[model samples]
Target chain A: MNAALSWLESLLVLAGLLSPLMLPMLYFLLYRPKRRDGLASPIDSLDARAARPSFFQRWHCGLKVACLLATCFLFISPRGLAVCLADVAIALLATALSRPSWRRVLARLAAMSGFLTMLLLMLPFSGAVQAGEPTYSLAFLPDSLPLRLSGLGAATLIILKATAVALLMEPMLSTATLADTLHGFRQLGVPASLTQMLLLCHRYIFVFQHEAARMWRGMRLRGFVAGANAASLFAIGNFLGMLFVRSFERTQRVYEAMLCRGFTGEMPRAAAPPMTARDALKALFWLALAVSPLVTEMYFADFMRFLGE
Target chain B: MHISDGVLPISVSVAAYVAAGAGVAVSLRFLRPEDLPKIAVVTSAFFVASLISVPMGPTSVHLLLPGIVGILLGPAAFLSIAVGLILQCFLFQFGGITALGVNALMMGVPALVCAGLFRWLQNGDRRRAMCSGALVGGLGTALAACFLALFLATAGENFFAAAKLALVAHAPVVILEAVVTAAMTGFLFRVKPELLCLPPRSKWRGKGDCSL
Candidate 1:
């Protein structure tokens, strides 16, 4: 088989890499964040802020997700590609169902575009050469169409795989609040100590950002301007050190308060409700749907060959 | 350099995840229970640090400070990086969940190595500490860039250009982090010398609390 990608695949790779640039506009056009109240939303109030799912409901969705991700990892053929695309479509549907803020999707797409671009640029040009084959070099007139086409294929595969998986995360992550998700993970058997630590760390990122900003303002008021020099470097160093010292002191105080409240290494968590038969069935259904493509692809490979003939 | 999802083959991504998982497990094991809050604080600091970019020539690069994390947090640095990476994934989507393990490994392993090197070289000399601080900072970023390249190259021969470009792009960051880590460590050495010590460990560990 020629290792290079076809022009169609190359175009798909490029499109996948660059498509996210339009996501922000799409998001704004499709989902507006503002209400008549004029209050800016951190996340959508509809699905994200609504009633939390039961432990069973959450796990059901979790199982479906696990199956979806596994299928994505397993299958790499055209049928497998269709399955991933289907999964992405379902995930996007779920995100729309949740009425999540367009900002979140926009951010996810924006975040992914850089890595996608890098992959698109690199994967196509780095073709592996077989014995007696022409070396694939970057030139105005290329010698190896096979190499270029294969490269395009590799790039497309990467872009598609990444895009599918990333799109799946939109619903999983943005559909619920962080607290609920953490609780879901806790229910799923992640250590409470770690989850608590994650929550604490997450919460403080905002707090410390504010503190750091105030400190930066203080530095600027004192005529500090960061530059590529020793003085500025040292000043920034002192600023970070100061931030650390203050944070450490704050940690001490917080720890003491927690200790006073009988805090153990791990925070106490409520036990999750037991799963029901319906939950199992729901999970099973989604799992079936998720893996259906793989099952069909495997069983139908011979049939596909026969059809091609 | 966040690897992003779908770049590396499943085999490579899985391998990176396993390696990163091992690192995180070891980090968790060595982490003292009492220092959970402290780790959280440092993790937040590291998270915020990555957001603040400093101007370098015509372009600006964000602070990574993996060296600083390794130096201060010691064995716990890997866990710290993992935590920071998770938040970055969720909040900023800086890296995808699929690539989380690889990104963590790229940043965390270098942190572990550099932290160890920094400690060994400093050996309580002020001059050595300053030089070692700078060296580890640069070395950490360089090592991370190398790891990033390695991960990208895992896709096959087709990604060498991408790998090279990625590595070259980080050169300025390498220098920047080196200077920043050096200055930060020196400043911490002078004031609150205890903060420079490898964070307290849970296991039977060395008692060099004030080594720097």
Candidate 2:
């Protein structure tokens, strides 16, 4: 009976270690089936959602970007687990209040699973082993594979902080159109050339994505399969070459058209509306909320000490 | 392979942001106003190309294309990469908002280095240029992996293992990028040789191909 229990524990630990490697397979098997109908444009759906007015939508784009990004930085600050949890709770509340599509938020989190899983698998064993630092060893496993508790705690903190910032992204970006958000960056002193490039690049990504899908389908019809081989890589290379050729030709025509429509060296910028007192108040509220977790972690040592222990 | 938020210490993240900003400023110093739209359009194509996933055993890896972008765009590759990364962050959340600086530096620095290497080595004929492209493509991925490992190591002693793992994972990708970039270069040489000759920004008249 004792041996059986030890074997079970070893299997559990092994499973925990290997699960992350299985995630990509599972993700493809479950989620990829729904995406067969060509590439769906995320921008159209996001723009439609942004058309709806909400509390976050009312804030000036420049101020909104600054405040939310500040919150994200604060979320990642070193703190106890309780403070991390509070940061996550605040992020979730902000996300909910902003009224974004639940599906998109979940998708954002899913995109992060790969990197986080890597950290989860490697950090525990890789941490510097110190004297008296707690470690977990399993029966039927190599003695060298000691999972450090301190490393586990560090990983957990990273995971929580990463999740919080990722959740906050939907509320920060989806509340405004891409162009408007970029315009906000311009107002915040980002170079105009860079902002223009972002806007123009974004506008054309959908077009090129469609072009690429069509080319891919055509390649498939010609018996070109994408596999782990030189032949597949060669075919993909040809496909990309053709894509670049076509895009370069199209750019000349596009530029000519723009010139015909009175294109100057610079794109015209729309003047931003004056900020109001309510916008300031909302910004202050969010800023304070962002700061609360750090304050609690730093000042209320007695309250946070128990959670740390 | 992009770094996510909260993975790096705040100080490292801030320092990366500053370094990446300086890189962009240097790239932008040679910018031509009239070429803005062209660069933007090319950037879209680069973005789309990166979305393509090539199958590996059991799993797959997406193309980084830093070498190709560098070879094609020359001095503008850094700026183009920075823009592409920002779009990836907002649209797909591939890299975190705060970690954007780190991601850009990881990819963009290699692109610049590969571009310079290709320009120096490419000579003689189409076959030689293709060989140079293959060399630079593999080198670009290798360099990016090194940067990633170096950045992760900055977090603490605990992350040293993760850093090593990240480097090893890119080994296969380096080979894959090499083959694809070579094939693409060969195709371009056959189809439109003019694209291979990216003229210096000051000398480009923006109307016709440079002397080939």
| Candidate 1 ranges with C-alpha deviation above 4 Å | A1-81, A129-147, A177-180, A186-189, A227-230, A300-309, B198-212
| CA lDDT scores, all candidates in order | 0.69, 0.83
Q: Which residue pairs in candidate 1 have backbone atoms (N, alpha carbon, C) closer than 3 angstroms, thus clashing?
A: A3-A150, A4-A146, A4-A149, A4-A150, A5-A149, A5-A150, A126-B158
Model 1, B47-114: lDDT tens digits are: 77677767678656687888888888777888889889988886666777777888999999999898
Q: Return the lDDT, model 1, position B187.
A: 79
For candidate 2, write residues B1-212 as lDDT tens digits. Answer: 89999999999988888899888887777777788888899899999889888887777888899999988887788888999998888877888988989999999999989988887876537778789889999999999999999999999999999999999999999999999999999998788766766444322236325321
Could you tell me which residue pairs clash in candidate 2? none
Best by TM-score: 2
